[model samples]
Target: MTGDFTARVTALLMPHLILAPIALPMLTAGLMLLLREERQRTKVAMNVVSTFLGLVVAVLLLVQAKQPGVQTSLGVYLPGNWPAPFGIVLALDRLSAMMLVLASTVALATVLFSAARWHKAGVHFHPLFQFQLMGLSGAFLTADLFNLFVFFEIMLAASYGLLLHGSGRPRVAAGLHYIAINLAASSLFLIGVSMLYGITGTLNMADLARGIAGIDPSDRGLLHAGAGILAVAFLIKAAVWPLNFWLVPAYSAATAPVGALFALMTKVGVYSILRLWTLMFSSGAGDSAQFGSQWIVGAGLVTMCFGALGMLGSQRLGHLAGYAAILSSGTLLAALGFGQNLLTAGLLYYLLGSTLAVSAMFLLTDLIERWRNDGASLAPHEQTDDAPFLAADLVHTQGLNLDEKEEVLIGQVIPAAVAFLGLAFLACTLVIAGLPPLPGFVGKFAMIHALLNPLGLGSSGGFVLGSGGWALLALMVGTGLLALIALTRAGIRHFWASHDRAAPKLLVLEGLPIALLLTGCALLAWQAGAVMRYTQATADALHAPGTYVQAVMSARPVPNSPGTAPGANGRPQ
Candidate 1:
């Protein structure tokens, strides 16, 4: 028994071993802002540092992969010797590490992409960008809910400045909406936190988990209500349906690098949902143990349908991508809510692949626009000699005479590249739609299998909504088909149409970032199995909350930070 306990503790602490590796770039970036004398030197320094950060995170993830359990919880630093559950605690289980790696890679790529142009306009872009990275890394690593909120606010505040970097009317307007919506969500987040503290008398997640395990019968309703309210904050962040109006405008208005960074924002919301559901509301080992996750699945189904529809209808390329991301988020939520281990695993892979692909697309869009603006095209605009070729006008041209090589290259090479990225995203959508051959199909299949079981949802906690599963399946298929059709049509129009006028040549600086992203996406396709294994392991960890509580409760207390004593309700006791 003692050996088993020690093994669990070791498993929980393993993930944090690489924290310093990840934090190096963030600290360097911050320090450079004050010390670096020249803008050119500072930008160069930031790029190298950010790239190093990515490499470190990649290494950490690789190390974590070699380990079996993939769990780690860091008690407060014990700075000056403090006690834990009271000190600032940092934790990195499978989910946190997965998210950290994703965020790190995306940030590094964007920073690399922006290296040449970030400081072009005499702004302190490097420092702000570095701070943003810090905020993101901290948000993923922190275990405390309040600290998570603080980190989120830090990121958002940095994002607001970054979004309005160029000082345009559209960007300024979008920033307002972004700020307003997020502020509202933040308010609700605090309110939910207050309610939880008042009732449970503890804020530590592990403590809250133990507390939730033994809730009073009469207070369960109140606890559920608080949970529901807290969920609303995350939903708003996730850009889930009915609360997703802010996503399109905000994403479209931000620059490509900014947009790419924003791609990780939704995962933050999903992370909270996963943590809360797994730790606080997990089903127990009894005939009566049903946590009512079907509601989450139902929400996921609707979100998937609505998101796909929105993506199809969007006119602008940026807005289309925005809608597509929302659709993807919906699918992710639905998959997790589906309450099948396979589906959760699928969701994990889909998020990783989709973020890489969409982020690349966002960055690529900027490059395309820049190339068109830089006069790399064979045919310059007849009327506006100086301005970039109008994207809409390019589509309006009827036909053009081109050499065979040009035809092959334009029709084949460029489209193939774009198509490759599109397919990566399409794979993600297909998975969301629960299609076969992809993880999504596997996940959906598993979910259906679970639901069909006699003792599963159909048992005591079951709500008999006739044909609900079939209806959801039909919606998934229909929307999946529409999204594919829409994407294919757009691809044909953008890539195949014979405008005869070359828009621009690709720049190494502008194009390489996306190329890196495409490579990662392809790798995701290749390594789907390993990715799914990680996801399944993560889901298993989530389902079993005892391991998490035990690790935190038994860890050495940090000096000056007192343990949260259990309340009268047996919560945290």
Candidate 2:
């Protein structure tokens, strides 16, 4: 215990390690902005650096996973080393590490896919992407509410630019709504933080988690209200249900790769909900049943229903995919809302599967868009060309129109790539739909098992069931069926239909990203045990808030400070 304390305190006081993840990209972005030579090379360099950084971050996250509850901070300059109540702190733990890894992986894939377009457009793409990453990583790591706001702004501001990167009528219009809604959500987030700070007298998440209980009951209402408001802020970011009106248009209108990247934006909000609910509001302090758990479930189910219906209703392929992404998010949030330790474990794994699957699909859509028969340039704002080619054009579209020689040529060039992508997405869909032999299936099975378990269903306690559980079960089955129907329908149309016309072959640049994502899904299917264990541990930790409070409130001896002596349970003497 003493050693752990010393290490925690020591980690806090130490200089930042490498700072490679944030620094290298920011530096590259700077260089990209200034140096105009070899645009393609510059873009390639960006993708390479981002990929390298992701690998490095994954390693660091793995190292951190070895010590889940311990607090660590790398950047000292952000909050000037102030502890707890007075200044900013960026705290990393098991959940944040998981999110960081997922975000980095997705970001790296998106950047790689976008490489082909960046060179042609001559945009300062690299720096914006780097900054976007910086904001996302910082959001997960930061422990201070105000600083969370800061990073949120940084991320959204960067996203605003990305959404409008190569702007046009549709993108500009969609970006307006996206920006307006998020800006409003951001403002609400700040307001909620201020109210919580006023009541609890602290802005640090750990400190607030520790202090939240002692506040007056009325003041606790304010805290719950604050938490609820914050939940809305995140839900807006997550695009949960009615509040999610901005998502489809925003996603469909933005660059395909950019939309793929933003698919993660919703997860960030979900991550925050998981982090804060577990860390701060698990006890009777916040009417968690009403605010923390039930509401999320309700919103999630609504989101799922809405998204599935939207997908069924939409004719546009990109919009259909966007709705599907939203539905997957609802499943995640609803699982979290169930508030069962097992369900949370399920939520974690489901998150991984959905993120990888959605990301791969978005990139694939971008490639498909490029292959439109009109020979029309895909504008920055358009999902893709809407014109339909003759059924006979499929052969020509395969670049096989001229001769057997041309057919061989085209097949050798990019048809293999397209075939690989289609199969990958189909695999992902199976996972997403909770079919067997995939991690998504495992995750859903675990969640359903938890829901049906005797203890949770009140077998011993006389038919007692949590409000969120039934709704969640309904959502799980309901959404799964809807997704199955919708995706299968779309799949048959695109891959199996007998048509003479084929869209042009997509650029080969996206091959790596698609491969990376599909490989991740396969690995997750193979090695879900470790992830499920971590998720279980995380859920258990959240259920037992005492473990967290004890860890954060306890103090370590400062080398020369008189007040640093060990006290009860190593808390300040």
How much lDDT does each candidate structure score? 0.65, 0.71
lDDT of 1: 0.65
On residues 1-573, what C-alpha lDDT tens digit does candidate 1 reach at each position?
Answer: 999999999776543454553366566666767664466665666656766656676557555644654333342232212234675556666777787778878877887777757544436666667767777777766667777788888778878888887778898999899999999998888988888877888777877877775777777777777777888889899888888888889888888888888888887888788877767765652321335467666776777777788868865667667876787787677656645554455567777766776677677666544533453334443646534345434433635433533232234345444454445445444443445565545544544554455245323223333465565556656766766666666655554555444445444665667767766666665677677677767766676767766766665642222564432111110
lDDT by residue (tens digit), candidate 2, 176-248: 9999999999988988898888888888777887776677877777778887888789889888988989999
- Whose TM-score is greatest here? 2
- Worst 10-residue lDDT window for candidate 1 reads 564-573
Residue 214's lDDT within candidate 2 is: 76
C-alpha lDDT of residue 42 in model 2? 58
